[model samples]
Target: MRDARPAALGVRPAALGVATATTILLAGCSAPVQLPDPPVDDATRALCTALVADAPATLLGSPRRATTGSLAVAWGDPPITLACGLPQPAGLTPTSQCLEVNGVGWWSQDGVTGTVFTTVGRAAYVQVGVPNSYGNTGDALAELASVVADHDTLLRPCVG
Candidate 1:
């Protein structure tokens, strides 16, 4: 019986090998990272788009992942995700601990899963969901402060 491989079908063996290798390489390189798309109003959506465009390529020292069609960004394998235009945090109070970093205010609330930090007093709320493993929420918030400030209007400042 004659050979019945790709070469026997008038295709070069080297070309077939290269094509298979290229396919595998492209597949490995093009994996998409999934992230949550927080719902927002039209005004907030516009602000979120601006924030996303200004977001840094890295967060907490990890390379920013390519998020799948969301007004959000992530870093690391199980990423530290930041979703903009979230509804105002229900837990915020007059006395809630707020920190100012690079002229932006953040209200932080700790939960079992992780620490949630929201930009306080901004016209549109931007939330950063930092996992417990991250250890330093401050750095992530600091990195994001300018982007949030540039895109959203401050309604009030963090009080002492």
Candidate 2:
């Protein structure tokens, strides 16, 4: 008997095989990055929205990617993720020393996975997490410094 499997399925044999292969290949691909959406007050949200809108289209040579949260933005594979309107970090005490970049104050704390730098003494809190693979946070922070300073109100200046 002649093969009628493709005809019964209403598709050509070659097309059916191609479609199956495409699906299998796509299944192995990863999804877009999803940033956490932390709770923020109304004023903070407004500031974050403005900052996000004015944020750079590219960072650290990587084109910006669409992130899941409104108050967050990311760039590149192994993304450098930025989240705004975060609560004050416990480590940010009166004595905490921070890096001053483009007039923006950032507190840097390194972890096993990566280094997380959060803006200190701003009206609205902003956090940027740079993975270890990215080498260092300097370039990333410098790129973002002006944008963060322009949008987020500086409550207290950071020291170098």
Candidate 3:
């Protein structure tokens, strides 16, 4: 009875093993993460395409997941999604602060899914949707920032 209690509270050892195996299998055979393609001009599309292509294959130790299109991508189980060539963040203002991650500027907002970060002070707006399961999004942002810095034009310094 006591053993059963532990299993109910957490999970049975056998069940845990099965779940782990299933996770591994699902990782390899994952459906593409679907994100809305933003409406942007040809020049913005070109910029975003370069940034998306330049993004690393891995983020926060998780391999990039299959995503729907060039405008957006995702990674890991919970799926950290990145989208480029977006409109300016609605919450942002002239006085808003931009946090620098690996020299790229990002402005953040707490959303239902997690923390949503939009790139500031650049030629194109880039958004990263990070689920709370990933904990600190900084690690994930740093890698993506490198891609942005490489591919996008810097218009103004990231305002701290």
lDDT of 2 by residue, 1-160 (tens): 1211111111224645554344224323433445546778888889999999888999889888766679888776566778888777665776688888878888877654467788888898788877677886799999998899899998888854
Clashing pairs in 3: none
Worst 10 residues of 1 by lDDT: 1-10
Estimated TM-score for each candidate: 0.73, 0.78, 0.78
In model 1, the Cα lDDT at residue 57 comes to 92
Q: Tens digits of per-residue lDDT for model 3 on 1-160? A: 1111111111224545454344335545686654546678999999888788778888888888876567877788766778887677665765688899889988887754467787888888787877777889898888787788888889998877
Report the C-alpha lDDT of model 1 over 14-115, residue by residue, as the tens digit: 545564344334334644434335567888888888888889998878888766646777666445667776666666766777899888988876645467
Local accuracy by lDDT, each model: 0.67, 0.71, 0.71
Task: lDDT for model 2, please.
Answer: 0.71
Worst 10 residues of 3 by lDDT: 1-10
- In order of listing, the candidates' clash counts read 0, 0, 0
The total of clashing pairs for model 3 equals 0
